[model samples]
Target: MENVKDLNHKPLSVKQYAIVSSLLFGLFFGAGNLIFPVHLGQLSGAHWVVAMLGFLCTAVALPLLSVLAISVTRSKGVYDIGRPLGPAFALGFMILIHATIGPLFGTPRTATVSFTVGVQPLLPKNAVHLGLLVFSGLFFLAAFLCSYKQSNIMTSIGKLLNPLFLVLLFATFLLGFLSPMGHAASQTVTSAYVNGSFFNGFLQGYNTMDALSGLAFGVTVVTAVNEMGKTNPISNSKVTAKAGVFAVGTIGLIYVGLVWLGATSLGKFNVSPDGGVAFNQIMNYYLGGVGHAFLATLLTLACITTAIGLVGAFAQDFHKHFPKVSYKVWLGLMCLASFLTANFGLDQIIAWSTPMLMFLYPFAMVLILLSVTSPLFHRDPVVYAWTVVCTAVPAFLEMISSFPPVVSQSGFGKAVTTFQSNYLPFASAGMDWVVPALVGAILGVTFHLVLKAKRNGAVESEKED
Candidate 1:
C-alpha cells in the first residue's frame, strides 16, 4: 500500500508551475484542436452550447484525466500504460499509438491542415497540388530540423511560439464577438447531430486524439516536474495535476471561443466544406487582407510546433526500441513519410484517420480510467487485461463498420455490424464499448478479491502447520 500522502516532496513554485503548464498546453493545443470545435459549432448551429459541453467532456476532461493517471502511476511513457498486459502487447500498442499520432495520420494532418488553411487560400486553384507539394516539402524540412534536437522543442514552442499563437487567436475571437456575424443559423441540425448532439460532440472530440497524445506526453510532463525539483511520486503527481488544470483551462477557453466564432458565422458565410475553410472565412471577415497573413502565420506555428513534438517523441521512442537505428535517422524517415502522406490533402487525410481514431479512442479511454482507479482493484493486471479486451472488441467492430460502403457492405463486415447493432448497447452512438468495459472491470475486481482471499487462506493454513 503506497500511500499517496506519504510520497510528497517539495512542490513547484507558482512561476515554475506556469511554465510547465504552458508547455503541456502547447503540446496538446494544435491543428485538430483548432479545427474540430469550429466544425462542431457550425454543424451544431443553435445547439452549439450542448455540443460544446459534450466536446469538453472528452476533449478537455479526458486529456486532463490522462495526465493525472500518468502522474499517479509514475508511468515513463505510453509504453508503460500497456506494459501490464505483457511486453509484446506493450510494444505493439505503443507502435500503433506512435504511428497513429506520427507519420500515418497525425503528423501528415498537421502539414495538410496548415496547407489548406494557410496556403491554399492564397494559391491559384489550378496550382493547388503543386503548391502543396512545394509547401509540404519546405514545411517538413523545418519540422525535421526542429525535431532533430528534442531538448530545445519545449523552450522554443512553450516559451516563444505558444504565447504568440494565443495572442493572435484571442484577438481573432475578440474581434469576431465584438463585431458579431448575425445569430446562429436556423438550419436544421445535421443528421449525425440531430438526435444526440452531446454524443455527436463527444465523438467529434475523438478526432483531436489529444488523449493519446496525453499518454505519450506523460514522459515529457514527468521529466519537466522532475527538472523543477519535484522528485517524489506524490509531489510529481500533484504538480502534473496542477499544470494539467492550467493547460486544460486554456484549451477549454480557446475551444469555447472558436466554437462561438463558428456558430455565429452561420448565415454570414456559406457552409464551408471543412473547419479549415470556415476558420479562414472567419479570419478574413474579421481582419481583412491582414487576416490572410495572420492565419498563415498562426497555422504554420500551430502545425509546426505540434509536428516537432510528435516527430521528436516518435523518433526517440523508436530509437530506444531499435538502438541500432540512430534518432536522427528515425526523425528523417518520419518527416519524409509525413510529407508524402500530407500531399494526399487535408480532406483525404481526415477521412482515412477517422476510422483509426474510432478504433483506438475507446481503448485509450479504458486504459486511462483503469490506471487512475487501479488502487481500488489492488492494481491487478487481470483487471487491465479484461477491460482492454472487452473494449477492443467493439472498437474493432466500429472501425470496420466505419469503412466505405464497398467494404462495410461486404459479407463479414455486414455480419459484424449486424451483431454489434443487435447485441451491443450504444452501438449507434459510437460508444458500444462502454457497457462491456464496465462489465469487464466489475469481473476483474471480483477475480482480484477472490484471489486475495484464497492467498490469505493459504498463508493462514501454512502458519497452522
Candidate 2:
C-alpha cells in the first residue's frame, strides 16, 4: 500500500500549514459567524455552553471533515462523493450550492448582514434599502475588481480584518462584562437553548456554509502549498489540519466570548428573541451610535469578502460544467440572482435556510462516512448509490414536508402538515428527515450485503460449470 504521504503528493512546511489553516478559519468566520453565537448565548442564557458545543460540532467538525473527505478520496471534485445521486442530482446539487453560497444564499446574506450590522445603525428605517442598494453596488464592484485581478484579496482582508474584528469584539466583551448589567428582568426567553441546544446549534452552523465551502478552500490551500514547493500527500493533510485547527480555535474563542457577552447583556437589553434583533440590541447598548456605525461598516466589508469568494467559486464551477458559457456571463447571472434574493431581509434568509439544511446535511454526512470507509465497502459504486438513494428519498420527503407556509399555501402545505402531524417521528420537530434517513441507511446497508452474497454464489456456480 502507498504510504499516507504518498496518498497526496502535495506537501508543505509547518509555517506554511499554519498560514493556510489560519486563512481557512478567517475565511469561514465572516459577518454571520460574529452574530449567530452571540444570539445563541443571549437566548440560551445559562444553557449557552451546551448550545455552543453543539454548534461547534456541526460548524467546525463537519467543515473539517469535508476537507478530510476530499483529501482521503483524492477525488477530482464534489461530484465524486455525491456521484451516487446520479448526474442530474449532481447538477441539482451544483445549482443548490450555487444558490446557497453564491446568489440565492450567500450574496443576499452579505447584503443583509451589511444592512443589519452596518447600515441599520446609521440610517433610518426607510433609508435602509437605499443604503443597501448603494452599499451593495459599491461592494459588488469592489468584489469584481478583486476577483478580476486574481489577487489573494480575501486572504489579505482576512488577515487584516480578523485581527481588527477580534480587537473590537474583545472590547465589546470587556465593556459589557465590566459595566453593571441594567437588570435581569427582561430575560423572558431563557429556555431557547434548553432541550436541543446542540442540534439547534448544528442547524445554525449550517448557515455558515463553511462546511460546504471546504471544496473551494481546499483548492486555495493546495495551490498555496504547491507554490511553496512542498508536494506530498501527508504534508498536504498536515497543512490542511494545521490551518483548520488555527481557524477553528480562533472561531471557538470568539464564539465563546461573544456568546458570554450576549448572555450577560440579556440582563440589561430588552432585545427581541430573534437572533438578528438581539445582535442589533447588543451593538446599540455597547457601542452607542458610534459602535453601531463601526459594526455596520465592518459587517459590510466582511460580507463583501465572503460574497466575492463565493461568486468566484460558483463561477468556476459553472464554467467547468458548461464550457460554452463565458465566465463573465455566468458571473453576471450569479450577481443578478443574488441581488434579487438580497431584498428579502435577514430573517427571511434564515427561515428559508432551515429546511434546506435539514435535507442536505444528512446526505452530506453519509457521503463523508462512505468516502472515508471506501476500502471497507470494497469501493462498490452500487453501495454508494444505494446508500445515497435510500437516504436521499426520505430526506427529500422530509424537506418537502418542512416547507414554510409563507412560500406555498396550497394542498402541498396541507399534505406536508398532515404527513408531519400523523408521523410519530415528525410530530415535534420541523425536521422529519433524521429518522427516515436513519431507517433508509440501515436498509441500504442490508441490501448491499445481500447483493454481495448473491454475486458470490453466482460466481461459485459458474466455477462448478
Candidate 3:
C-alpha cells in the first residue's frame, strides 16, 4: 500500500507548471488592459519602443515577481506575510484587497468597458447612457448568479473565452496593420522615460491591480493543488512555482502582442489623450459595424468574468475577517454595491480608482518586497515595521498631492499634508515615495544584520564566561 501510494505521487514538471500558471495569469488579463498601450502607441508614434519598454516593465515584471514571492514563501494564505502586523493589519489588508478587486474598481469597470466596446456603437443618439445602465444591470445580475454559486462554469467559460479573445485581438491587429488610414505625426515629449522608465512602467502596472490580486490568487492556487491530496510543502511549492511560470509567460505574450499591435496601428491613427476614443476610432475605421460589435461582446464577456472573480475574492476575504458573515451574504452585498457603481460608468470608475490605487500601491509593493526578502532578515518584526513605515510615509504624502483636498481634508488630511512638505520628495514626477522606500529597505536589512551579529557575540561571550 505504501509503495503504491509513493508510486502515484509525482512532482509537477516545468511544462505542467507553465500551463497552470499561464491559465492563472490569464485571469488577470481583461478588457481594460487593451486600451492603454494602444493609446500610448498613438501618442508615442516613433517613440513607441521606449514607451512600450516602460509600460511592459510594470505590466509584466511586477506580476511575475508577485507570483515568485508567493511561491518562494510557500504561504498557505495571503495574510501570512502580514504576521508581523498581527490580526489588525491582516484584516485591513483583506478589506483593502476585497474593495479594490470588487465594487470599488474591478466590477464597475466591466460594465463601462463593455458598454463602450459592445453596446454604445449600436445604440440610438440619445439612448447611450440609458442603454449602458440597463445593460450593466443585467450583466451584473448574471455575474452575481455565477459568483454566488462559485460555479466551475465561470472557470470553464474563462478558459474557453480567453483564447477566443486572443484570436479576435490578433485579427483586429492584423486588419489594422494591413489596411491604410491617415497617420499622425509623431512628437516627443520631455521627461517621457527620462525619470526611470522601469519605475514608470512599474507604476503603470500598478494600475492593472494584478499584483494586489495576486495575494488572493496565491491562496486559490495553493488550495486547488492541496485539494489533490498533496500535503507536502515542498511539493506544493513546486507546483505553485510551475503555475507561476506559466502564468507569467502567458501575460508576457499578451502584453507584448497587444503593445505591438497598438504601436503599429498608431501609424494610421491620430494621437489622442483619450485612450478610449482612440481605440474606438481604430476599430470603427478598420472593421466598421461588425468589428465594433465583436469588440463589444468580447469586452462585456471579459469584464463580466473579471467581475465574478473579483466579487468571489472579496467575499472569501471578507468572510475571513468577519466569520459571522456568510460568503453568500457578502457576495450578494458586493454584487449590489458593484451594480450600483456600474451606473456611474467606466471612465468614472477608472478616474475614482486612480487616487485609491496610487495611495495603496506603494504599501502593497513594499509588502511584496518585504515578503520576498523576509528570509534574509529571519522574518524579524522590527525590519518589517521600519521598512514598511519608511515606504508608507512617502506614499501617503504623495497621495495627498494627487488626491483632491476635499477627499483628504480630515485627521488623515492634516497628517498627509505635513508628510508631503516635510518628508516627501515632491520635486520629481509625483514619485516622492519611491526613493524613501528603497532607502528604508536598505536600512532595514542593515539593522537586522547588525542585531543578529550582536546577539551572536553575546552568546559567544556567555560561553567564555
Candidate 4:
C-alpha cells in the first residue's frame, strides 16, 4: 500500500547532488573518523589495504546503509524507524538516540577532543582548564550561529567548510606521499593485525561512531533532499542513497590515504599510542612548527561541521515530536548543554557516554537492518518486537560491561559479564549482539508466517461455510 504512493519528481542536478553529498560527508566525518583508519593503518602495516576493505564495510558502508534505511523506510527521522514497535517505544528510541548523539555524548566529545588534540598542547599545563573553557565557549557560539537557522547548516558545512578542509588535507596527503617515509608493504605488522587484519579493521570502524550519527542524521539528509524538490518517496530514496554513496565513498578513499600515511610513517616513528599522536607526527614530520597550526585548523573544521549537523538534527527531530517546543529553543538547549559539559564535566561525560554508546549501537544497527528488509516481513509488529526483545538482553549486557572500572567491577557487573562471555558468541568482543539479533529475526519471521497461514485458513473455511 505504501509502495503505491511513490510519485515521481525530477532529480537534482550534478552540482546540487554534490553539495548534498558533501553535507553528508561533513556531518559524519569528524575527529574519530580521522583517527581510527589511521590507527588501523599503523596496526595493519603491510595489510593496510585488506584492513581498510573491512573497515570500509562498517565505517563507510554502515552509515550509508543507515541513510538508505531512513530513505527506504520513508521515515522522516529516527522517531519513525521504531514506530512499528509502538509509539511509546518509538518516542523512547528517538529520545535515547538523539540524546546519545547529541549533548550527552558525541557533540561534546568533538569539542573536548579537538581541544585536547589541537589546542591543549599549546597551552601551559596550569592553563589547560581555562583554555578548554574558552575554546568550548567559542565553539558552541559558532555552532549556535550556524545551526540556529536550519537552512544555513548545509551551506555552512557543505559549500564552505568541507571543500576548504579537503584542500588542506589533500595537500598534507600529497606531501606525505611524494616524500619518502617508506612503503607500507614493508612495515612490520602489529601482532593483532598480523593475524586478522580485516576483523581488526572492522572493529576499528566502531570507533568512528558514525553509524549512530548516520541514523540521527537521516533528518538532515532527507531535509536537504526535500529542499532540493524531490519529495516523492522513490525519488527521495534515490537522492538520499546517491548522496550517501558519494559521501561515504569519498570517506573510504580518505581512509585508505590516512591509513597508508600511518603505515609508511612507521619508517620514521614507532607505533604511537593513538591516531592523534600519529597524525601529529605526520604533520610535524612534514611541516615542523607550522604543522601544529594546520592540525588545529583541520580538527576545528572537521569537528565544527559535525557539531552543526548534529545540533540541527537534534533540534529538528525533537521539534517534530514535541512541537510545543520550538526548534530554535531545542537548538539553544543542546548547544548550552554541550558547551557546559565539554568545559566542566568532560571526563564524567565520557565515562557515562561510553556505556550508552555500547548499549545503543546494537539497537541502532538491528533497527536499520530490519527497516531496510521490512518488505519481506510485511512490516509486521511481531518481527520488530521479537527481534528487539531478544536483542535487548545481550545489548544490555554489553552496556554494563563497558561501564567504567569502578562500575564494571561491581558484583552485578561481574555477573552480567560472566553470563555474556560464557554464552554469547563474540560477547567479550562487543559483537555478540549480532548472532542473537539474527536468531530473533528468524524467530519473528517464522511466527509471523505461522500466524498468517492460520488466518488465511480460517478465512477459506468461512468462505466455504
lDDT of each: 0.84, 0.66, 0.67, 0.86
- RMSD of candidate 3 to the truth, in angstroms, is 4.0
Q: Which of the predicted structures, 1 or 3, would earn the higher TM-score when compared with the native?
A: 1
Flag clash pairs in model 4.
none
lDDT by residue for model 4 (153-264), tens:
8789989999999998899889987995889999999988877888778767776778888888988887877777676767787888888888899998898899899899
What is the per-residue lDDT of model 1 for residues 364-402, given as tens digits with 9 covering 90 to 100? 998998888877876689899878888888999999988
Per-residue lDDT of candidate 2, residues 1-465 (tens digit): 124234334444565565666556655766787677777777666667777887787777777777777667654345555655578876776667566666766667877787766666677888977777776677666666555533464455445555676666667677766883543223444554567766676667777777767654555455455445545655555566566767777777777777666666777765455655667777777777777776776576567657666666666668778989976677677777777777777778877876676677767777777776776766566667766766675566556655577643568766766766676374444445556656655676777788899999999999999
TM-score of 3: 0.87
TM-score each candidate. 0.94, 0.85, 0.87, 0.94
List the candidate 1 regions with Cα displacement exceeding 4 Å: 1-10, 185-188, 231-234
* Runs with alpha carbons beyond 4 Å of true place in candidate 3: 1-8, 12-19, 151-154, 177-201, 404-427, 461-465
Better of 3 and 4 by TM-score: 4
TM-score for candidate 4, please give it.
0.94
Worst 10 residues of 3 by lDDT: 1-10
Ranked by TM-score, the better of candidates 2 and 3 is: 3
lDDT of model number 3: 0.67
TM-score-based ranking: 1, 4, 3, 2
Point out the higher-scoring one by lDDT: 1 or 3: 1
